[model samples]
Target chain A: MEIRTDYADGNYTIHVDYGILEASISEYIAAYSSVHFLVDQNVYALYKDSLLSFVQHPIILEGGEASKSFDAFKHITETLLERGIKRNHLIVVIGGGAAGDAGGFAAATVLRGVDYIQVPTTLLAHDSSIGGKTAINSGHGKNLIGAFHRPKAVIYDLSFLETLPHHELLSGFGEVFKHALLKDEETVRTLMDATRTKISLDMMKPFIISGIETKMHYVTTDEKESGIRKFLNLGHTLGHAIEYKYRMPHGMAVMLGLYFMMYASNEKAARNIFDLDSFRQYFELHGYPLEHLKAIDEVEMMTLMGKDKKNQSSDATGFVLMNDFGQCYFTEIDSNQLKKYISQLKESL
Target chain B: MEIRTDYADGNYTIHVDYGILEASISEYIAAYSSVHFLVDQNVYALYKDSLLSFVQHPIILEGGEASKSFDAFKHITETLLERGIKRNHLIVVIGGGAAGDAGGFAAATVLRGVDYIQVPTTLLAHDSSIGGKTAINSGHGKNLIGAFHRPKAVIYDLSFLETLPHHELLSGFGEVFKHALLKDEETVRTLMDATRTKISLDMMKPFIISGIETKMHYVTTDEKESGIRKFLNLGHTLGHAIEYKYRMPHGMAVMLGLYFMMYASNEKAARNIFDLDSFRQYFELHGYPLEHLKAIDEVEMMTLMGKDKKNQSSDATGFVLMNDFGQCYFTEIDSNQLKKYISQLKESL
Candidate 1:
């Protein structure tokens, strides 16, 4: 299936199929004089022959948290320069979130900007690919230095999902659940009813498409995340802090942050969409680290939240809070109130 | 005088007047919660009290060619992060071309993108500010990494032109001469009639406006520099190669390149508006290194030209050629033809 995102510049399509990489990519190969690949090393080793059939001499990098660093980004850009990559050339990133973020950012900044295609092999990429938010982590934070450049296209091949570990599946589901909770009652109900262990393409397709549509809905209107788009950062405030502090996977940290939000919003009578205990149980069954909420100190967590991009004022922090399903608003939470909520959530845990 | 550039995204204004920075900066300070200045150190030292009245504790950087390196870019970005600069924070860059290019690029990429104001103090900056092309030099070549991010506004206080040295005045004229040639026969006639040594604000204002208008006309329509915008690179092909090889000032190197272009184009019957010897004399009087045309090797220059962003095919390099006044076209020049042109140019010199 093909879904189109319309922007003021032009429209781009997302190609989703059970096995699209092996099927489609000839048009992309024919479009540019040079097609270079920046593949995740693990993905390169596993699917070397398949990728080689499409691209020649792919530059492989360490995937996951390792690839998102500024060092890796510099290496990729320098490699492209050494390879004589020109403006008309295309860079195709074949990997998960980290590879896409770093590679997409390099493509965005190299020669001012260049055309790049995203071939997402992991489920978490369903959220990252559509937004055109590319970045490399700084020593102080993740995605500190970045650009908002849309990819030429996103090719999501469902066949690669079979190779993902169980925890990776759960990590991917964190975003799926986020989109569902932000979407409507029907989506939340559907997500809550799904089995975490027996993951299948048939069961995941709708959720992936739904998540993309939800993201594109925010992105196409506000590509730079100036206004309503901050709603997408519903759980990312603490999620990013936790990810940076503990070196947890992005989606897992986001899952923990979501648990915090659900509890805080419920206590404040700000949102009545979900029963707190039931929702926690659903994520707990999927192996989310819900107990970490109690172990993390309130002061340290608040300090991390202060480092958020949306927190412009040095004294206060802004968060995407919900009072009802599909109704998210950016509200500035006072430091005292935020600390109080954190303490209460910790006590409950 | 105010000139506005309207694009699909938003419109930006250029404020061109004498002594407008102190008078006009208050509105900018009031508009954003944080108005941090990234001023060139020399400029800051000279006008510390004046600048302090507008902004407190501005980030100082070594201006000119020193600040255009990748290392300088990293230092400035890290400084911004260390200071807790956020998405909403405005970065006002005050300096010459290097400061504007490097700081504007940092503002463009930090937190995906941020609002930046350009306060150009040098004559060369009049060209850099309006174009929205920000870049940092790479080891491989100049401007290897950059982005097309337009400034929120360009506050050009013409009073700073008094501090410019005689060579800087000549440097600024290089771009003006190119613009005049591309604009029409009248502009060329106006330019050729002027004395090179006695450049004054009264004489330069019209040319500055003319260059900006020529630039904004192309940039407003094609912000990405993908199509007709390449016309602005009239003398830049060899200009960049010479600049990289000999370490000459950008506009001075461009003046030499323009002399070569005028001579070659006249010989090839590409254009015959101006007498070659008279044009050469005009630039030579301004301290342009016209004689160095014989010193630069044709093969080495050709190799450097191949590294240009516009060169997609390995066999040919594109140059902006003019058959008539105001009719510049990007024509592909093969290596053999380029060598012939260079030999003929040196012999004539």
Candidate 2:
């Protein structure tokens, strides 16, 4: 499936298909005179023969979250400059979210701006690739330094997902679950049915397309994240805090944060769509990191959440909370209210 | 004078007038919910009372080229995060080119970008403020990492120019001279006439407007610096090399680079529009750093120029050479040809 985000400047396409890499790689090379590949090291080790067949030189970086640092960004930039990469050249990032964030930012910056393509290898990248947000992590938080630079295209080869570990698959599903919950009840039902049996790469195609479609709906309308795009941060507030404090993977933290929001809504005396037993059962079956939250103190978690970028005040936290499915709104939750919600979640756990 | 660059998103205005600071500061504060100032330390020390009247807590950074470092960029990002600066908040940068580059880049990346206002305090800032190009320097080169983030508005108060050192006044004229030469013969004549007398803040106003006007004309038409915008880099190829190697100030280096291009064109049997004695006389009278080039070797300079972001090949160099006034084109010169031109320039000196 080819999803085109038609903006006034140009059309940005997200191509999702199995075995599309070889064909799309050549197409990108033909369009750009200078094409530099910033590939993940682990991905390179696995697909080096395939990638080397097309491009002779690829800058291989570590595949994990540590690669998304200022040092890595500066190193990539210097490497590109040494290679004589110009503004008109294309940088194709072939990695997961970390690779896209760092490499995309480097491309966005080197010589003021350059065109970049995202070839995501991890399942977690489904949501990240759709949005134009590119960043390197700051010591204070994740994605603190970045820009809204859209990729030239996103080549999502589904075959890569077959190689993903179960935990990685679970990580990607965290976002899938968020999209399903935020989008509508119908999407939620579709997601539940898809996960009813063991999830495979073949069965995941339709859900990946829907996940991207749900995200693009928000992105195309608000590219800058000034309006409805803020709704897309549904699980990210406390998610980022937990992710930072515990060094938990991004999607898993969001998964826990989603549960927290559900509890918070119920405490605020709002309708709870997440009260269903299947929600809890499915999360447990998939090995979501809910047990990690049991050890973390509520005050420490609250302090981390207060430092979130979306918060208007340092004392309070802003949440993209939903009283009902498909109706998310941002609200400021004071420390007292946050403490009450935390106690309720702890008791239930 | 009011200059408006009509981008598809919104109108970017450059307000150039005497005593426009207080009124414009209030106007910007009225528009943004939270306003923070990223001020140059030198500028802050000189104008603390005036700045405090507008903003209570300002992030004071060291003024000059030192501020345009990756460390400074990182520090500013951490500072903003610590200050609880949200996406909707505005970052008002009040300083020269370095402060603008660092602060603007921080604003461009912090929370994936926030609207920034440029309150320029130097004569050279007239050029930097109008363009949305923001960046920090990498170990490889100056401005090797950055983004093309235009400011919401550029407030250029003439009062700041009065406080500038004599060398800085000469420094700004380098760009003004380049603009006049690139713009038209009429602008060139106006610039020459203005410099014939003892230059003051009042006399420089119209020229600053014209320099910004020339830049905005190119920026509005080709914001990405693909085609016509490359004309703006007429002196920057060798200018950046010299600036990088010797640690010369930006505008003074451009002044030398402009002269080199003129000599190269004349050596290539092109008509010498740069054959004016007053041009050399005016430069000497204002203390432009021309003697620095005498000590630097041609091979070292050529090697530095090869790594320029504009060059496609490592061995070859691209120069924005003007055969005639107001008519410039890009051309590739091999190392041997570059060596010959440098020797010719040495002979003339």
Candidate 3:
């Protein structure tokens, strides 16, 4: 089912065809025509041959999470400097979440700020790429240092996703599952029901667009994460700490985090729609877990949450708890209470 | 003559205000409705009542050159969180150049970007108060780690100057003097002429404005200090090293750096424009040049420039030597040029 929707705020466009990439990028540059660029390295490598038919400037870098560090920032910054690219010029990044994040951070900070375009290549990046969350890892933290630098434009082509392994597809679905759980009730029912049907590559365009729409709504409400959008972090507070502690991918960590948050909450709105039993069975079918809260150290996990960027004060950390589908609020809860909630959930599991 | 000039962008009024103690920040903030404030504690103590009447969010910090370090950045960023000020909030900063620089840096980095206003309360801040240059000092060097963050507004109330000491006035004027040599030839002449005339504070307006205007022109052209504005650094490279070695105030160091650079280069542009006879005579009258540049390690000075944010590369360091009034360019000059220049100046002295 292609979920029909529209966004006039003009941030993102999903492309299902390979034919539109070059022409769309050229049009953006012409409209914003301050500078030109060649993405010489990194995720740009993935599309070097294909994009050659389009872009004049090409820069590439190694593709991975490890490459999203300060050293990479330094390398990319140096390349821009050598090319004599100033504020007038644009840097184009086309890749997965890591490439988009790192490139966007570098572009924003270099010479105080320059413009850049995002052509995200991963299903997971469908979430990571659109938002203005550009970051680089810092001492003992993932994305500890970053900037809220919005991209000039985000152009996504679904044609790129056909090369994915099954796990990659599952990982991407994990984030879509997150939006469904936190915001859209029908989305959760749709995903669960669709599992029985053919979840083909082309079938996902609408789902991807839906996830983008949901994320954009959250972003527009609180771009700096100072308001209701803190609810978006509902699963991520414990989820990120888990990602660090267990060496899990971000999507996987969020899945585990949601599992615990769902069990702990007593919201009638959440319970009325989501089938906890079906979700548990689905986790098993997907080779995931609904248990193992005991595997993580409670004290150590809270310690990492202490360093989370959202918890900026002495008294409390901001938390996003789901109240109803498609609605949430940013509330500061007692860390002690959070410990109690999670501990209770572990007991039930 | 009291010159009331608008930047042609805003309706700000510069006045023939009394001593720095008499400067009214309340009127300034009221005129421009700022949202958030990051101010140094010492300055806050002096004007907390006045400030509280205006700003909704206030972040007070300790005062020092070292306070411009990243530790202070972390502190203010935490305060921003507690107050819950997001990207859209205005950040009002009042204090010495150090406070404005550090506060501006903090405001710029938090949530990526925030609006900033400056109320400079020191003689040295005449330069720092206006320019978009904001930075934190590091073990590596001063202003080595910084960003070119423009202030939304600046209030240069002369009242802040009355609290300044005589030595500080002398130190701050070093930058003012550099501006004179680079652009404001009449201001340069006026400052020298003032040495012969009675150097009363009120009598010094034209000279001060001339220098301010000169620096403003350079700032407008090269806000990031990437090109033509480097000429403003003619004496700064050696001046900063002098500050590091002798532990003098910034203006004093720049004055000495100026003397050395001008003496080193008999180049018509550097020499004819930065008139040495007037410089020597003025310093003699002011009882400055408290220490000589004897046995100074030119190599160490060159090393310090490496840590300078302007260098852009390892082998190439940029210097803006005066070519003529209102004209300067950032040219690549190696340590070899630096050594020969310093040696020539040392011998001449």
Candidate 4:
């Protein structure tokens, strides 16, 4: 499948298919004067021979949240400079979200910005690789330091997904689930049905494409997160808090955050759009560690949430809440109200 | 005087006047929910009482090229975070070019970017503050790490230039001279007449405004240095090499570089546009250290020039060369030719 995106800053296409890496990458290589690779270690280990056959001396990064650090950023940029990377040269990032974030940031800031292509390996990256939001975690918070640098293109080869572990798959599925929920009730229902059975690449293909398309809808509308782009942060606000406090996988934490918000906003017309009972069953089946909510200290989580970059002020935390018919809007909730919701959410969970 | 700029990325105003700092800054402070100040140490020391009366606890930086390091960047970001800088807040940078570059970069990447205003203290900053280019030097080269982050406004208080030392004023005049050359011959002749006598604030104002206007022409045309912006690097190609090697003030090095390029490209109808003997006399009158040209090793300078980010390949270095009618265009000069020109330039000097 070929999906084209037109952002105010730049325009690029996303190509998704099984076993399409070699041919797609070769075309890019032929076009650019030179190319460098920044691959995730796991991805390198799984396909080293094939990767080496095409590109030489790839800069390998140990993929995960840990890789998204100032140290990792310094290493990649310095190594690339030592290797004599130029302004015209392209850096192809082949990995999951963390690898892409770090490598993309290096690409963005190196020589004041360079072109790059994203080759997302994990399922979660399906959501990340599309947005121009490249970042590295600062000492204070996740994605606190970054830029809105869009990629030249994204090549998603489903072949890499076959090697993903179950937890990794579940992690990626969380974003897919969020995208579906943002899309429509029918899409969410279809995704829930797909999860009920054993997950496979065949079942994931259409949903992944749809998820990217749905994300692009918001991304294209608000490239810099000034308006509609906030909607995409559906579960991310509280999700980031839980993930940081418990060191949980991003999407699983997002899943739990989504439940909390749904529980908080699940009233009147919102209840019609979001079926709480059905989502709870889905969460239970997916093994999303809901126990984190019970164990989480309300004050600590609230403190973390208060530090969220989205919040406008210390007294209130901003959230993208759903209204009737799944329509999302940004609103500020005070600390007391949020604390109340957290306690109630923990008990309910 | 107020000048407005409209670039593809953003639009902002540049206010140039004498003693406009307090009034201009107060206006911005009123508009923003909160504000933080990043002031140069020298400026703070010079105007401590006045500065303290306005912004409390301003972040003071030792103003120099050394301040444009990763360490300084980390310090500023961490300090701002600790002080509770929010998205709605603004960072007012009060310094010369170096402080603006570092502080602007911190503003650009912190929380993925915040609005900033530039309060230039030195004459040289007239050029740097207007451009959206914000950066820090890497171990490999100058400005290897940065972003194209535009400022909300630029407040160029001419009063600050009254206390500028002779060398700093000369350094700034180099850019003003370059800007004049890029403009019509009449402007260059006027600038030459202005520099022949004792320098004062009144004499510098028109040149600074015209220089900024000339720079904005190129910047607005190509916000990202992909096309016409290359012309603005007229003296910068060799200027950067000399500055890096000799630890010279930026514009002073640029003055020498401009002389070399003019000599290299001087021939036929080009002679009508450029007067080498007159320029040499101007350099001598201004106490520009032209002997550095003779002292510079050709091979070492060539290697340094080769590493310039603008170069297309190792074989040929890219330079913005002037045509017969003062029209500037980018061209690649082979290393052997560049080396030969360097020796000839040294002899001519």
Candidate 5:
């Protein structure tokens, strides 16, 4: 299936299928004057022969949050230029979120701007690859430096996910869960039921599409994240803090973040829409490292949360509070209030 | 005079007047929740008291081409983050092209993007500030890394030019001259007449406005420089090569680049539109350092031109060649032909 995105700044399509990577890449190569591939090192190792058959010298990048740094950004851009990447040339980013973010940013700023296609190998990238948001982590914070550069297309081939480890699959599913939560109670219920079974591409494909669509809904309305797009960050405020503090996988952190927010903002109606007990059971069943929530230093997490780009004031941390499924709004909670909630969340977890 | 630009990507006004800096900045400060100033060091020193009155702790930047580096970009973004610059805050860039380019890029990439106002302090900036072409020099070439991020407004306070050194003024005029050449012969003649007399605020204002209008014409029509916008780069191909080689003022190199291209693509109608000899005389009269053209190493220059972002192929260099005023086309000339033209240009110089 193909999902087309209509953003205020740009428009592109997302193609999701079982084994469409080679054909999609070949198509782009035929369309553009030239193509440059920026692939995850692990993905390169896994698919070395097939990748080499198509790409001349794909730029290999370490595939993790750590690789999304200024140094990596410089390396990718410098390497691309050295290889004579030009304006008309397309940069095909074949990796998870890290390679995509850094490589997408390189495509955004290199030669003022160039076109790129996102080939997501991880389930987590299903959400990230759809948005034009490209960034490299600054020393101060994650994704502190970036640009809203849209990709020409996103080719998500699920066959690659077959090689992903259990933890990595869980990492990507975290975002899928967040999307389902943001969508509606029905989606949340369906996603919960889907994950109850052993993870498979067939079980996840529909959720992935729905998740990207939900993300695109906010992104298309506010490409710059000035308004509704902030809704997409429902769990990310605490998610980023957790990821930063514990050096955990992004999606894994986000899953915990979702539980914390749901617990903190546990409105009567929201609880009716999303049952906290069942969600806890799901986490425990999936082995989501709920223990990390108990270990989080409230002060450090609060400090990191305060630095979130979404925050409007220094005194408060901004959050996307969902009163119920399909309903969310941005609110700023004072540090003291937030710290109390953190304590309550830890005790509950 | 105020010139409003209508670019496809964005629209902004260019305010060309004397002593408007203080008022313009004050207006923005009153409007935005908060404001940050990124000022050229020299400009800050000259207007320190006045600037301090309006801005607290202005980010002072080195004012020339050397500062347009990735390191400077990192420093600006890091420092801004350190100082607690948020999304709603405005970044008022007070400098010439280099500072504006670097600072504007920081505004563009920091937090994905933010709004910025351009306070052009040099004549050259009247052109650069309006276009939203923000960039930093890469190891490979000038502006090899950047984005097409527009400013909210450009406060072209002519008062800043009063403090500019002669060469700096010349650098700015190079763009004005290029704009005039891009425009009809009437503009060229009028600009020539204006420059022939003592350079004064009143004398330069009309040309600066006209020059900006000329630039906006191409920019508005083709914001990404995919088509007609290439006309604006008539002199820049060789001009950038000259600037990179000699470390000369941008406009001065452009002035010589203009002369060389005019000579190489010396069509009969074009000569009628722009007199090469008189244009050369204008450069000499204004101390444009034409001897740099004589010092040109053809091979080195060819290599530099080959690396220009505008080039489409390795075998040839792309150039904007004019048959007459307002009539130019993009063409690719082989290295040998370009080198022969370079030597011929050297001999003529």
Candidate 6:
């Protein structure tokens, strides 16, 4: 079933398990299918069958975490320029979260922002697809270089998610946990009840709405990620540093950070949230490395967070610590206290 | 006097003449002023004393029409890549038409469409400044490389006009004539009546408004510059070819195109709208050459136009020609007839 999720700000649709991709694309300009933005080759090869069955021009790019760089952006843009992809054509970016972010930013800037559609092929995409956020990496940090240009549309086809590895799928679930912890109640309950090893399209409906609802709410309110919306970064400040330093996937690092922050936060602040023990047990049960935080440099990790784009002022470091399920704040935690939490966690671990 | 012109779709401000050529830039996160994306060496030397400038970071570049190329875009983006221009900062572009178009597109694609402002120095900019059309030239053609990203604001300071030569002053008046011919009465009457060799800021006010009104009318109606808005192109088809071939300035070629099209148009389409004899007399009185039409190659010009991005389909020839003053249409004239008109003019001249 092809269902379009609509909102006041924008609408995104899911091209169910079958022929809906072609139907949705036909509604757009004929030139859209020709946009050849850079994408990961692994993700592309896995999904090219479905995309070529629908997309006219598919430019497969080399993939992996390392591909997220300015060099990559230039290479892809130059490729698109060589192909004569004018501003009139739409640059459909298909792949995982990083692909969406990097390709989306590339499309956003190439010829000064061409039209792009996000055909998310991974579980992580439910967060990346809706927001206009597009960027590549500088040596500085993840998402340090990027832009806010909403895609014309997002086509989420559940069929592509079949290729996601078990780790990547669980990695995507971290965001789902976040949405529940930060906003709605139904999300927390829904994930708590997941019994199946593989998440189906039917199983993803509410979480997708809840995730998009959470993301769009923040985007509309902050639009720029300037103030309140940084609350969405709850576990990210420390998690990003861990992801950077240890070279772990973002979701794995975030789980470690989430486990640490549950105690690092004030007891009153974290009360009535998901049972911290269960949160830890569930990720561990899923075979995620919840204790990776013990191996990294606490001081370096703390210092690297001051490097976060979310840092508004030098003295204050932004933290999206949770108070309870459905409540959070993007308030800053002083470096001194953050160091204390880091040291304290290290000692306990 | 600083008077702002709002185009409903966008807005601009005209800072009337003053001595010392004062030009100021205040960097902001908004789409107009920033130090991130601009190239202004001549402007800097000319107005540095009176300019107010602040940017998170500023970088200088060698300036010229050549500086507005894709190579220039690469250079500036590399600088942006080097300096860490977040998508939040606008790229303040100050200069004449070329800088506005090139830098605006750079800002558009850099980080996926940052904000930009135009500080138009040329008299002809009274027309180009109001619309969001921006580009860099490719070997393919003038404005063949570009995108439609409107400026957040435009500052039309008459001080920039001081650098213009007499020919340039006359050349700029083509747009003033264009605005009048396409729509505005007061502007035409004012231009016809002005005997002062130097136009004062106050005297230029009505013409600025008329240009803004006319272009804005077309842009808002057709932001893409496709159907009705192509009417704004009146003489541009032949004019662009003339500019490309003869290496004439944009406005001069356009005036020549207007003259011929006016003469060749059907009587019902012509009538009292354009008196070709007086048109010849007026430009001749103003030192414009009446003989360039002799050298125009009708076959080549028509062939070049077949590749016009505006021509929708096939071997047809289209013109944004006039039904009368204040009325224009994207009418497809017969290729044979258009060719005959050009040949007849070539023979007569």
True contacts kept of each: 0.77, 0.89, 0.10, 0.72, 0.66, 0.10
CAPRI quality band, candidate 2: medium
Whole-model lDDT per candidate: 0.83, 0.82, 0.66, 0.85, 0.84, 0.67
- Record all residue pairs in model 4 with backbone atoms less than 3 Å apart, i.e. clashing: none
TM-score order of candidates, best first? 4, 1, 5, 2, 6, 3
Candidate 6 lDDT tens digits, A206-324: 67666767776776677666677677787888888888888887777777767766766654364545565666667677777867766777668866776666664455567776666
Query: Among all windows of ten consecutive residues in candidate 3 chain B, which has the lowest summed lDDT?
Result: B13-22
Q: lDDT, candidate 2, residue B264?
A: 74
Instruction: Compose the digit string of candidate 5's lDDT tens values, residues A112-229.
Output: 8889999988999998888789999887788989998889999998888888888999999899989998899889888777768565566888898899999989889888787998
Put down candidate 4 lDDT per residue, B1-349, tens digits, no spaces: 9999977546989999987888988987887888999998888888877633576889988778867988888788888887778888999999999999999999999888999999889989999998889998888778888998999999998888888998899899888888988997788878778767655566889899999999999999988888988888998988999999999999999999998878877742346356778878878777888889999998888777776777768788898878743488788888888888888878877
lDDT of 3 by residue, B1-349 (tens): 1333334443233333443322344544454323676667777777666533444445777785866755676567656655555444567787888998888877666655666777777778878776677766655557644566677666666755665678887877777777777764676676677656434466555667776777667666666555766677777867777787777888888888777666655453444655677667777578567346756777877776655555555565566665555555556677677677766666655
TM-score of each: 0.96, 0.94, 0.65, 0.97, 0.96, 0.78
Model 1, position B1, has a per-residue lDDT of: 89
Off by over 4 Å in 3: A1-19, A26-62, A181-183, A197-200, A267-273, A292-294, B1-107, B110-123, B129-132, B135-171, B177-193, B197-349
Q: Which candidate's DockQ is highest?
A: 4
What i-RMS does each candidate reach, in Å? 1.2, 1.7, 6.6, 1.0, 1.0, 5.0
Candidate maximizing lDDT: 4
On a 0 to 100 scale, what is the lDDT of residue A19 in model 5?
A: 74
Candidate 4 at A308: error in angstroms?
Answer: 1.6
The true-structure Cα RMSD of candidate 5 reads 2.0
For residues A126-158, write the lDDT of model 1, one tens digit per residue: 888888989887766888888988998899988
Q: How does residue B334 of candidate 2 score in lDDT?
A: 89
Candidates 4 and 5: which is better by TM-score?
A: 4
